[model samples]
Target: MLRVGVLVSGGGTNLQAILDAMDQGKITNAEVAAVISNNPGAYALERARNHGIPAECISPKDFPDRASFNEALVAKVDSYDLDLVVLAGFLVKIPEAMIAKYRNKIINIHPSLIPSFCGVGYYGLKVHEAALARGVKLTGATVHFVDEGMDSGPILLQKAVEVKPGDTPELLQRRVMEEAEWVILPRAIDMIANGQI
Candidate 1:
């Protein structure tokens, strides 16, 4: 099995999609080994528990320093013996050492199609807000290999969603997530698991 460890910081809607896909056998060669979140209150942890997967919270605040927290994060991820690490709405910037160690093994789901409303300061609803502010007719999501730079990784998959008139940032974000993020992320995981990527 392709063991996967997922990191998240929020409601984990994307995480739920992955779990649902796996339960439906859309991803046959993979199993979610664990779910780790920076927020103790993150529903993702609850979701993981509900599925009987190992769940943990390793917030930076719990450690005395960022370096310690980073090291702990690395160790925690390492403990799972994961073949893949998925950042599904994980807000933390991965530590340099972790990035170096994991290299192409890490992948992230960016809210935008990338090279657009991506990079630093463009996350969550902020991405949709920027797209709406710029009056872009099309905005989407990207699943990419995680690199040292923010959303600068090599692209794996992308799917665009239409921007409707009178759409608020929240509405647009939901649409993009449902139409693109939810679709391509699972597909990317399956591709990797099946050695098709």
Candidate 2:
């Protein structure tokens, strides 16, 4: 079995989706070994705990600088002996060192279809807001390898959702999450774990 480590900083809906898939046997080769969150109060931590998965919160504020924070995160991740790292709603910029260490072993799910409303300053509801403001007829999700650049990694999978008339950012975000983000992330994880990537 492949040991997977998840990184998150929010409600962890995507993380929940992956966990559910695991429970349903959709992902047979990988198991979530641990969850790490930058926010101590992140609900993702609670979700992991409810499922009996090891979870930790390591604040970047506890460190003196970005490098030290990254080093600590790398140490935490290394402790799990993970075969894959999945960033599900993790908002921090991964340090170059961690990127070098994991290479293509790390994957992230972007809210937008990527190369679209993605890259710097485009995360969470901001992505949906931009898409609705631009009046795009369709917006969706992107699963990709995590690299040094901001969401500039090679694409793994994408699924588009209709923008819908008069859709608010909140509504669109939910649709994208339910219709796209929740679907492809686990598929990508399964693909990676099964050596199909």
Candidate 3:
């Protein structure tokens, strides 16, 4: 069985989906070993706690800079002896060193289909806002390996959500989460665990 670690910054809606999948027995060969968050108040931590999973808060502010913080984060994750690391709504850019160590072992769920509404500054509602501004008819989510570049990794799974008429970024974001991100993220994890990716 694969032991997975989750990283988050805000509400762990995707993390919740993964736990639900495990509960439903969809992912039979993997368990959530731990959950870590940069935001101490992240609801993801609460969800992990509810399930009796180890939840940790490692604040970047505790460290002096990005390198130090990434070092600390990598140490904590590596300590778990994880088979895979999933970034679910984790806002911070993972450092190159961590990416080098984990390589394809780390994966992240993006708010939109990559090469579309992605890159350094594209996250959260900003991605949806960009899609809406471009008047796109369809936008969705992507799950991919975490590399040194931002959202630039081998695509694993993708799911599309319709861009409804007169939709706001908030609405699109929610729909995409429910329709795309939440769905494909778990599927991607299971695939990796099964060596399908």
Judged by lDDT, which candidate is best? 1
Could you tell me which 10 consecutive residues in candidate 1 have the lowest summed lDDT? 111-120
In model 1, which runs have C-alpha deviations exceeding 4 angstroms? none
Tens-place lDDT digits, model 1, residues 50-112: 999999999999999999999999999999999999999999999989999998999999988
Better model by TM-score: candidate 1 vs candidate 3: 1
When 1 and 2 are scored with TM-score, the better candidate is 1
TM-score of each: 0.99, 0.98, 0.97
User: Candidate 1: which pairs clash?
Assistant: none
RMSD of 1: 0.5
Off by over 4 Å in 3: none
Model 2, position 139, has a per-residue lDDT of 89
Question: Quick one: best TM-score, which candidate?
Answer: 1
Error of 2 at 32 (Å): 0.2
What CA RMSD would candidate 3 show? 0.9
What is the Cα-based lDDT of residue 83 in candidate 1? 95
- Which scores greater on lDDT, model 1 or model 2? 1
Relative to the unseen true structure, what is the C-alpha lDDT of residue 182 in candidate 2, on a scale of 0 to 100? 91
Q: Please give the lDDT score at residue 97 for candidate 2.
A: 85
> Each model's RMSD to truth, in Å?
0.5, 0.7, 0.9
